[model samples]
Target: MEVIISNYPEELTFPQEYIDNVKAAAEKVGELYDVANGEVSVTLTNNEYIHTLNKQYRGIDRPTDVLSFALNESEEPEIEGEPEVDVLGDLVISVERAEEQAADFGHSVRREMAFLTVHGMLHLLGYDHMEEADRIEMEEEQRYVMEQLGISRDDAKEKKAPKAEPQQPEADKKAKHKSGFIAVIGRPNVGKSTLVNTLIGQKIAIMSDKPQTTRNRIMCVLTEPDAQIVFLDTPGIHKPKHKLGEYMVKAAEGTLKEVDAILFVVDATQKLGPGEMYILERLQATKRPVILVVNKIDLIEREKALPIIAHYTSKYSFAGVVPISAREKMNLDGLLDEVKSYLPEGPQYYPEDMITDQPERLIVAELVREKALHLTRDEIPHAIAVDVDEMTTRPNDDVYIRATIYVERDSQKGIIIGAKGSMLREIGALARTDIQNLLGSRVFLDLWVKVRKDWRDRDGILRNFGFGDER
Candidate 1:
């Protein structure tokens, strides 16, 4: 299960343990409902953002503690083949509201946040509280999950205070903070970007079905008052075919020695192939603790995943093995718990609000490229790269971005442009929405398509497009 947490507000700060609580809460709900193969996107935002969403979607002017948008209730598009990940739905949580309510109720914010996450996940699973009977059942389910997670009011009694006071803040401040860097390395297209995006609670890295989608080593930060985990989302370690491929492989292996730890993510659905064995062989040389992340467990049953887990465990002595659906956001709290055990006491490496080191230009360009990937077919090829020629703020505060999508063939350019520029328009419409969410402002995206033949093989051209610099 994949539990993606996206913190929208830059200034939102809280204890990192609350994230574990959130994941645990969501996982408990899954356990109760027997939903092992599911995905839940948990978005942490401020009242301002939630208020906007509430007004826009629910016709409510005020911000709510949580809002549920279950895809199960809607008509989700089905892929041609069997789906690898089953998306449960989305949960929009207002952190500001949760904090306020926690104070009002005289409980710790961790408890309040956990309740909200569990309550929200339940709603996404079709549990409702409109009627008295439904309300009773829903509350009972909530209590069961909380109890199962050992986070019930009774379970957390020692952590609670008589009243919210300055002493609690002081105690929190004095608590030892832990911070570390963990590199997320895996075979190509193993949901590394999805996992990182979910962990950071934002989409800083571009994601697609295409192999070698992530060409750069993206540094994503997850911060809390007590802990900060900076993640290095490296390119998939694969055999290189060109300069760009060699650079990608080199860049991925480069981080193994420098990072405090590593997350070796693999697809649970795929057999233990030579590519995976190759990565495991490389891991043999690294003394850094490596946590085996069995991703995409949603595609298979728990019983089936056992043998896959066994296959990898027999090959290498991992620091820990965590089965998760990075797309569904499942059991991530347990994964974090294992990570926390390895973190050393240290200073917070980055500010609480900074989520990623990628500049706006790169993110914007990647967003466009991701859209192009989604819009085009195999005939177009994966030889597309986006360059943001101009990105400036206009007088009215809207971002004016002029970007060009470079393809290897004229036919590919035509495919992206379409017969009447329809495809480009569609891409812009889709990419603009994500750009707005990322930028938090209205954006006027101007996109162009051009042919850059065999740029992947050319060193200067590849470097210009933000490749070969990872070392």
Candidate 2:
């Protein structure tokens, strides 16, 4: 089998080993199907571009890690002349989605990419999972091909084992260490980010009082002497007002499948509404432990918080209920203890020094947006998004960064710019301080406000701004 690979979004870089893995998986698929020879194409891209394709072809309108366009299927137009060789369809894989899934599944991205490639190849050979028998057959074939290629789930686990440093004592190695992922989810303005930051003991996820302040699923690592918890701070779930909101809801819901535990955060002061009820209904379907966290207890009396906890407890069988103030960092230790008790014994997923899995560029962009959310009023915060266009460091000078702040309307643009560009300057200055602290260097930030009219509703514009399906 001949596998042709192309990297889309030109900016992404993949190692030679990744390309080799895909080729090997494709060849294994061909061998399994007894094909004399075949051809396949793999395109590597980000979530936004693949999400567009998924919506266009599959009509699901969400970003998936891998999509198969099989030529053997009737979806392809036929030509009159016979072909000299069999041509399998094209496979489009999202590198970003692969990374996210790899981390969630506790494996290497190479393994994830290889698995996706084999799955796509099987699909190209007319394998599907629409029915039980077909699903079993396809899964069996996928496992057989992956095992032949030395890329089974166990292989991935072995590949992901952490390397020992200067070495710990035998006693330390014998000690049981727990590790697992916990997802923090709730409706908008429920203090989810604040709770995650409190648990991680760092400012990894950007925070603001504005609704939907967090647009992406931010992962933060908390490594302790006995346990390591990877906390996924997802965007607050809300009703879909635009394409972005729909993506956020999907991103939050997607975490339910991959996490070992779920933290259902809710504002203690607010009455139990449809949003919390909606989340409760979803949580009922998952077998994993769900911990009901009634946040903002500092604002409400103990008497008030009791009913809130009782209300949620009556609805579902939560593993535990803890009322605390994420802002005040109250009773967080209890919450952490509860979380740790549920985690099974496992190896550390990330290095201790690492605070978050997000790239520096994404952190900088979020910082910029955090400032915008705090400074703007009304609907401006929801209409705004920041993209880091450039970030470079000089040999003997400050690091320079150019970022664009996108809004949905001309009037909102004027609000962001302010009179004589005062608001823009303020946003830049505030954002620069955080950027400088984050990079540990002096920084120069250039702020530009551009109007991308109703970008939250347009798929193409959302992709350009980096608000892919992952967000």
Candidate 3:
């Protein structure tokens, strides 16, 4: 028997041992059925793509653990004369679903993959489980094959235990390093950016009391000696009142498809509301590993936090629950450990020295906007955007930057400029200090204020201000 495996999702990789296990399982099934010569193809894909395949082929609108398309059962032409080998139908397994189930079952993903492969092979070999009796028989066969491969449920659980002695080689230890992308997402002003900064030990994303502070997706990378966790700090998901609001929500939701895990940050002081519920439903649909992070634990008592944890646990089955104060940097190590367990074995996406992928100009613009958010009234922060028009360096001197702060109305513009331009000067001074620190040089700053009426509602102006359609 021959097994061919292909990975459709870049985040997932099938080790040679897994492939060999699948081949052995296929051959064992064939020997049991008196057909030793056979071949099977396995395609590993994510939930979104598998959802489409499920809808198209089985008329099911949701993703499942596995799908088997038996060629023998199809209406295609059958070859004449004696066939050289039996070509069993293809098997499509959702790697995302496999990871989730493995975590839930307290087993390694290799066990889950082998189980699904055996289940699909049974389907290909004319096994039907529509009836109770047939289902038992098929399950029995599955357990027997898995036991033969030394992959029983007990064996998988034993693999999770730590050995008393460290017998692994240095090369094998290095090869076990894991790396993947994680999305930190939540409702507006839930401390998403603060949590990201705390995790990475750097301030790459701007933070403010105002909602929608993050307008674009910012990627911050945390590289440890053994793992690299690329964190995508997304705009908070909220009800859209304008074009900018819509873009923010879309940006947060879009990260669900591409990330290895999601940190669903929430305000521990606030009660669970419809906004959280909306985000939870979306997370459930992705079938990805979601770690519920109740941020700002410093603001609430431990007794009160228990109820909040219970409330969320009752609502959704999160892979892990962590309580931390992003402002105070409390229990963040536990959060990182939870995140690291879900990431797959892979190479680093960015260099170890690099903390963020954001351009310097964009970071500077966001810094200016952060100052504006901090100083202005509640009504002004959401309606404001800063664009760095020019940034240049003089030889052995200082970094010069000119930026325009856009407001939605003339009144708002007046507030930003302030009496005798005091507000604009203050924003520029604070931003200049941060910019200087970032560039490690002296800085000269020029600031201007402009009004782009209803800019958030206008797509053309939004695009011009860097809120493009691409999420």
Candidate 4:
């Protein structure tokens, strides 16, 4: 069956790995059932738009969980023109709702969304939970698929302990010594999050071999002996050309003023030039001790690394010069040791158990952005912005998400839509996979696209897209 999955109103915000899981689940289920071909349309959307859809299609007065529109009434979807691809009708999900449900379910937004995508896909395959037996079967399949994708409901899945001695006797509970900030900074695509993951010893910050995938400052904490290090994983620094660019740069610069120490990450394999120099200029102004972290040493020779390090050292009087690979987890301890030495004494900023300070909904929106950044190529990154319009969870334990994908122009919209909606279908297919991963259970993601006429330049559009206003 030709499964035509599309995100409504906008592209989804999630990771690539999550998207892969959705595709794998589809192939596996289709193969097991001996279904030769099937076509399902999955769209990502926001609350207002999905509310419109719910009102128009289902005659429901309010936005509900996932709404399934089944074209095959009697049996499984039949292969229409070609017996190889069966048309399985359409499934619309609200990303905004999926994010809300994820928070309610106490899981990563990616997990919650993946669950939703799987649930919707099953509906397209004629799997319904209206009956108790069918509901159990569907739920079991969801869990089975999640297991295959290496996703866990356990909290330990994303956590790390600081290397420190056992707790010492303390006179006061709040007087315990522990608190510092490790600000991660770099030009866009320098593997800052990879370094954070290495330090945290877990996948807290989603990593991909893509540039500008991280849009916000994600703080992951590590409590060491007499100190709790808050690792601030900032967005990749780059020239500001759009509203998002300006905001991302502001987020990066803001950390410089607040943090105790800074980890200036650089792609070791690439030549150090203007971008590196521009960042260096910013570091020179910061009073905090700067640790020059030359990442991706795995891609270079020992001899080559020395010269690169030498060249950078000559350019700036960095507090410390360290060479290591973030992805390979090399020389991380030494880097952490340097960071510890620079930390100022203070109480723990967050409880020892807390890893991040970002809200679940914001992360969910970021996850959708991550998915879109990877799926769309070239200048599409600048053209795309995801807005969580409506999110709600039902008493029966299902999530509803609605998201909007905003583009700058009508031509760009056409580019996103693709030939006879094939491109849009591809975007949905890619986004649904991750949405399912984030939501964990059944999620209804409704996606849509709208042209705002150079939103990057318009103040109102920027404000609506969560920019133009001081945070």
- Which residue pairs show collisions in model 2? none
TM-score winner between 1 and 3, please give it: 1
lDDT of 4 at 164: 36
* lDDT (10s digit) by residue, model 2, range 283-310: 8789999998889999987777777788
TM-score of 1: 0.65
Tens digit per residue, CA lDDT, model 1, 285-394: 99999999999999997799889999999999999999999889998888888888889987554434457778788899999889888878565666889999999988
Indicate the residue-level lDDT of 360 in model 1.
80
TM-score of each: 0.65, 0.64, 0.64, 0.59
Q: Residues 329-354, candidate 3: write the lDDT tens digits.
A: 99998998999999998644443446
Tell me the spans in candidate 4 whose CA falls farther than 4 Å from its real position: 1-176, 201-211, 224-226, 419-426, 429-440, 469-471
Native-to-model Cα distance after best TM-score fit, residue 214 in candidate 4, in Å: 3.4
- Among the numbered candidates, top lDDT falls to 1
The number of clashing residue pairs in model 3 is 0
Error of 1 at 140 (Å): 53
lDDT of 3: 0.82
Which wins on TM-score, candidate 2 or candidate 4? 2
Off by over 4 Å in 1: 1-175
Off by over 4 Å in 3: 1-175
Better model by lDDT, 1 or 2? Answer: 1
